[model samples]
Target: MSVQALVRWVAAGLAALVVSAMPMAASAQQPSKSSMALANEILDIKGSLQIFETVIPGVVEKSKATLLQMNPNLFKDVDAIGNDLRKEFAPRLAVLREEIAKIYATRFTEQEMKDTIAFYKSPLGKKILTEEPNFVDRSMAAAQDWAVKLNDEVLQRFRAELRKRGHPF
Candidate 1:
C-alpha cells in the first residue's frame, strides 16, 4: 500500500481498538427493549454520541498532510487516496455511531435520555447542537496549547527539584 493508504489503514484499526475499549456494562448483555428503543431515539436526535462528521474528516486530512510530508513521492494521487480513505471509513461510521449510542444508553437512564432528546429538539437547543462541534474544536485546540505550555513548566520544575536532590540527568 502507499503511505497514505497505510496510515489510513492504521488509523482505522486504532479507532476500532478505541471503540472496543468503551465500557461494556450494558453491552455485556442484550439491551432491554426500552433501552434499545431509547438508544435508537437518541441516535435519531443526536446522530451520534460524539462528533465524528467533522472530526474524522479533519483527522484524515491531517493524516494525509503528514503522510505527504513523510513521503510525498509515494502518493502521486492525493485526491484518489483521500477518496479511498473516506469510502473505507464511511461504512464503519454508522456502526461506530450505533455503538456510541448504546454506550450512552448504558450510562444514562431512559428518562434522562428522553430529556436530552427533547432539549436537542428545541429551537435554542438546535442552535447549540449545530454550533457545538465548532465551539468544542476551537476550545480543545486552545486547551491543548495551554496544556503543552503548562506541562513544559511543570516538567522543568519537577526536574529542577530532582536535580536539587543531587540527581544527575
Candidate 2:
C-alpha cells in the first residue's frame, strides 16, 4: 500500500486500540459485579464510554478525509461515502467490543478490573481518559516525523554500504 494509505490504516488501528484499552468507569452507578460481567458492559448506559463511542465515528471521519485527500474529485461526495462507511462498519462494533472485553477479561483479574475501573472514575484518571485522544494525536504526529527522519538517515547509510559493495537500488 502507499505510505499515506498505510499511515491512515495504522492511525485508525491505533485509535481503536487506545479506545479499547481505556478503563471502564467504576462509579456506583457503573459498578460491575464480576470481570465477566464487566466484559459485557460495552457501554454503561449514561454515555460513560464516550471515548469508546468515538472510535467508529472518528475512524469513519478519518477514512473520509483520507479518501478526499487521495482523490478529491472522485470523493467529492464525502458525505455519501461517510454515510456508507458508517453503515458498513457499524454492524461490526458489537463483535469488536466483545473481543476487546474478552482480551481485558483474560489480562485482568476481577479485582484488577475493578481497581482499574475505580481509577478511571477518579479525578486524575478521568482527566487522563478525557485527554487521551489529544495525546494520541500529538504523539502519532511526533512519532511519524521522527520515524521518517530516522528512516532516511538509516537508509542513506545502508544504501551507501550497498553501493560500496557494487549494488544499487
Candidate 3:
C-alpha cells in the first residue's frame, strides 16, 4: 500500500480500537492522574499509540509531494525540507498520545482501565493483538467486494426502472 493509504488504515484501525474500548459516556470531571496513567498503560499494551508515529511523517510526505508537483526542479530541496520538518514535528506526537489517553481516562474509570490492561496482557489478548490486523484486512476486502456487487445490483435496478419509463439508454 502507499504510505498515505497505510497511514489512513492505521488511523482508522486505531480509532476503531479506541472507540470500542472506551465507555459510552465520558466523565464530566477531569481525569485523575491515576486514571491517566492507567490509560497510557492501556495504550502501551495495545500498541495503539504507535499509530500516531506516522502522522508527522505522513504530513511531511504529502507536503513534499505537493511541493514537488508545483516545482519538480526542487526535488532535492523538498526532500531535505520534508526530512527537517519530520524531525521538528516528531515531538508533537506526544501531544496526540496525551489527548488520546485523556479521552480514554475520561471515558473509563481507573478500575476499568486497570481491568483492560490486565486483559490485554493475557494470552487471549496477545492472540488478538497478533490476529486483529489480518482480520481487519480480510473484513475490509470482503466489504469492498460486497459494495461492488451492491453497486451492480443498484445499477441493474436503475436500468429496469428507466426501461419501464420508456427511457432506456
Give model 1 RMSD, 1 decimal: 7.4
Per-candidate alpha-carbon RMSD to the true structure:
7.4, 8.6, 2.9
**lDDT tens string, model 1, 10-68?**
45544754765476743576556788688788767754533455546766788889988
Which digits, one per residue and each the tens of the lDDT, describe model 2 over residues 12-56? 665766665554433213223476576554234212343355567
Model 2 lDDT-worst window of ten: 23-32
**Per-residue accuracy of model 3 over 27-90 as CA lDDT, tens digit each:** 4567888999999998888888666677679789988999899999999999998888999999
What is candidate 3's local distance difference test score? 0.80
Stronger candidate by TM-score (1 vs 2):
1
Which portions of model 3 miss their true places by more than 4 Å? 1-8, 14-28
| lDDT values for all models | 0.69, 0.64, 0.80
Each prediction's TM-score against the native? 0.54, 0.53, 0.86
For model 2, state the Cα shift of residue 4 in Å: 8.7
Q: Which stretches of candidate 1 lie above 4 Å from their native place? A: 1-23, 53-89, 155-169
Taking all chains together, the TM-score of candidate 2 against the true structure is 0.53
> Which scores higher on TM-score, 1 or 3?
3
Give every collision pair in model 1.
none
The Cα error of candidate 2 at residue 21, in Å, is 12
